[model samples]
Target: MTRRFLFAPLIAVALFAACRPSPEPGAGGITQVATIDALLAGAYDGTVTLAELRRFGDFGIGTFHALDGEMILLDGVFYKVRGDGSVGEPPQSETTPFASVTHFRADVREELPAGLDLPALEARIDRLLPQANRFCAFRVRGEFRHVRVRSVPAQSKPYRPLVAVTRNQPMFTLQGVRGTLVGFRSPSFVKGVNVPGYHLHFLADDRRSGGHVLEFTAATSTLEADTLHDFLTIRLPAPGAAFEKVDLTPDRSGELEEAEKNPAVRD
Candidate 1:
């Protein structure tokens, strides 16, 4: 009875986002489904289907419905990194509650120096993209000494807040692997609407396993970044939608910071 009661609203939002007009395929700019604040507040139900999301862009990061796992959309395919550290391609019918993607035509290409971890890699890319205000989508492909990632298990009804869910989130460590890091860097102004800084997800070369990126030391990797001047956001457009009811007023920056960074690593 409790499960059915809680699921009613989630169903409403999904129906609305589905009926909303799909964006034209091959569109430019950053298209984000829903907002980060809502996700933090426990808006786990998906508001946008993968098939519709694919029309927006080919490269980006997001989470699955019910916060089932991490998402990596690379090269026109959607890959799921489950909490158990397994990777699999999700069907187009799957939905996403929060995602940010853009057409990935690299405007800058550079070879990253070996031994650069996530922070160092981000700093290097930041130097290349001096226009800090605009959004930048990037992909880094090549060898890595090791990469640490984490993913949350699927949630049931009466969902707890995101920070709470991630408290026991599972983490994985992969060594000497080759894969692509699909990610985005948003301006600080997008605080509640999107992750203000870098948000990335990883997928292995063999398509076996990967998850939300925590830390990594790259070895001779090549990077490509695309600068997007235009921004598009598709919220749950239905009137009186459940996602619309999620209270987003409180500042969840502290919770977000805690959930995103790996505790054991502070480099």
Candidate 2:
């Protein structure tokens, strides 16, 4: 009788689960706003607001229109990390030229070992990946032995290519700190469309400082990963002179690498 009673509840639970609606497409996948090519080709015009971006996903990284500042999305809130190493919540009216976000349900959670530099951390994370071509989102939180981050100030009309804008970016390095690293790892096939490898942004525990992560050393960090297999959706800005006139035909991979990896514009 006890066995039959348990079986009855199991059947009822199965029926209830079967009746539940499937998750929507956006809820299950990554929603990318704009293209890396457009941003590279000097399209700093924001077409999506923070409010709209939030609706698609709550956790991700992206920059504001005109490449104003580094953007860090955490716990459903959007923050702007500036060149002066200041972090604040920008007005919701502000928009983003390029951003990638996911609803962030981690499929893998692990506690990584201590004393890993950027390359080592990447190599270790590489082993954890199930495949090379798939897109994945990563979030690591812990004490960083050293972290180099950079942020660019806003530009005016007649925007310059990302490479040029990065030339004047401000770099900051924090040592022996507690913080979180948020970013995405795109496949090599998406190179020109998005960063081919890991593109990460850092936010300190105090929430007072952050920027695009250039390098870092971690100590027993916790890593959470979410695989994005559903789709990558891109939203472009409306037809305008800014985006229409920009020349995107040239290959800017080398230039982008220089800018993103070692843009040391100031002393």
Candidate 3:
């Protein structure tokens, strides 16, 4: 018997904040609200390092270290250190290394009021584990943000499980890629059975067979006997990359294909 669980439609809400068109230097001499693209370009221009890139999230409100070991507040604005050691708008893109900061913003943000129960959200997601385990293949579609998984099942023992991921989610920002989870296997085997705390780490790629791959990991853990495990993390490669499935055994070079019949469960 097949069991399915679905999540409630996510309601999109907008937050209202005081609008300031220009940057204002605060007491600490930090510029607030820099463009997303400019921040990335500055990092790429050698003013910032990959290590810095990994520290900041999409929100862009955090503290980062400069070359001189001083802590600077990254208020999401482009700034330049002057000859007098003061901060100001660095040279513009045409004159300097970066052209403009990219406009990247999150689709939704909300502050849960104090005393709001967060465990309820976790409970709701735990109920959907069975549904996520049903599919085993996926593809990246239009806009580089849509991920589609095949609805068919594999014909072999120890069925493979797959998950498709879109670029609009937080996982995309963390991994810097647009792809899907492929070649997942459960430690416990029963066709269509949901195994708690079992997951596989695979590479995310556009195609199931060829391209650059990034490590994607997923797992389910039991909160209680009735509550199922929820997905922990999923990663994919940068946009436009392709990936092909390969065998995971000793040879690790053969193409991946669906089995004719399900294989016996592992002990």
Candidate 4:
């Protein structure tokens, strides 16, 4: 796999000494399709084709190009969980701006406790992590007492920024349901490059509903995690006129953080 581990000069010696060799591609590692930086910079136009996405990994979460719908990769199938909360298969022509996937070979599996909301559930998972810096992908399956999610509608060209789009996102809450939560816990250093900490998306058992998970209370669920030691492979959109003209110099970390966790940034 293509690996990039250029540590800062101050910590290069110590960090390099502790780092392990990156594994070859397709070897139980996280294969992310695009960078969050592009999304934050408003590269909503489709870049990587769906056909190209499947070649990387199967279980992951992302949004369709133009933010048309939320994406859920479950059981090797890509489902477009749209703003109306309807789930359907997007065409092979559909594309994604950002996505992270892995073959999903769980190295750890355990039962989760009941009555835990998003923060509690995250804390529980945090305790189980082998290390803070290593990449980890999660797949939690089972019944949920309650779940709250949000999905944004497709935007026209000359699209508004994601923060504005999220402000108008449609939210849904379902009770007494079975589903799977697909997500990853990226290192804090990634910050603007990707969402640090847990970023999860949910898909129901009936495959009728799902979106970006805001909150959830699991009754009895199993949490499966794949610890990724392999380096990340990032793909950027084909630099076209629109991509080249758009200014990506500003840091949108604050807005992205609010949009992601609160779901009420506009309120």
lDDT of each candidate versus the true structure: 0.87, 0.84, 0.21, 0.81
Number of residue pairs clashing in candidate 3, backbone atoms closer than 3 angstroms, sequence gap of 3 or more or interchain: 23
**Candidate ranking (TM-score, best to worst):** 1, 2, 4, 3
lDDT for model 4 = 0.81
Clashes of 1: 0
Tens-place lDDT digits, model 3, residues 21-95: 223212111112222122121211123332323222211111122111111112233332221223333322212
Q: List the candidates ranked by lDDT, beginning with the highest.
A: 1, 2, 4, 3
Could you give candidate 1's per-residue lDDT for residues 1-267 as a string of tens digits?
A: 999989999999989878987556445588888888889999888878999888888888999999999999899889999989888888999988888877888989999888999889788878999888988999999998999999999999898999999999999999999999998988999998898889888888999889988999998799999888776565463566459789889999988888888777634
Error of 4 at 28 (Å): 3.0
Report RMSD for candidate 4: 7.0
Error of 1 at 164 (Å): 0.4
Model 3's TM-score against the true structure: 0.16
Question: Which number leads on TM-score?
Answer: 1
lDDT tens readout by residue for model 2, 185-230: 8889887778888899999999888899988889769999888777
Worst 10 residues of 4 by lDDT: 1-10
For residue 115, give model 3's deviation from the true position in Å: 11
- Candidate 2, which segments miss by more than 4 Å at Cα? 1-25, 263-267
Q: Model 4 segments beyond 4 Å from truth?
A: 1-26, 264-267
Greater-TM-score candidate between 1 and 2: 1
* lDDT over C-alpha atoms for residue 30 of model 4: 68
- Could you estimate the TM-score for every candidate? 0.89, 0.87, 0.16, 0.86
Between candidates 3 and 4, the one scoring higher on TM-score is 4
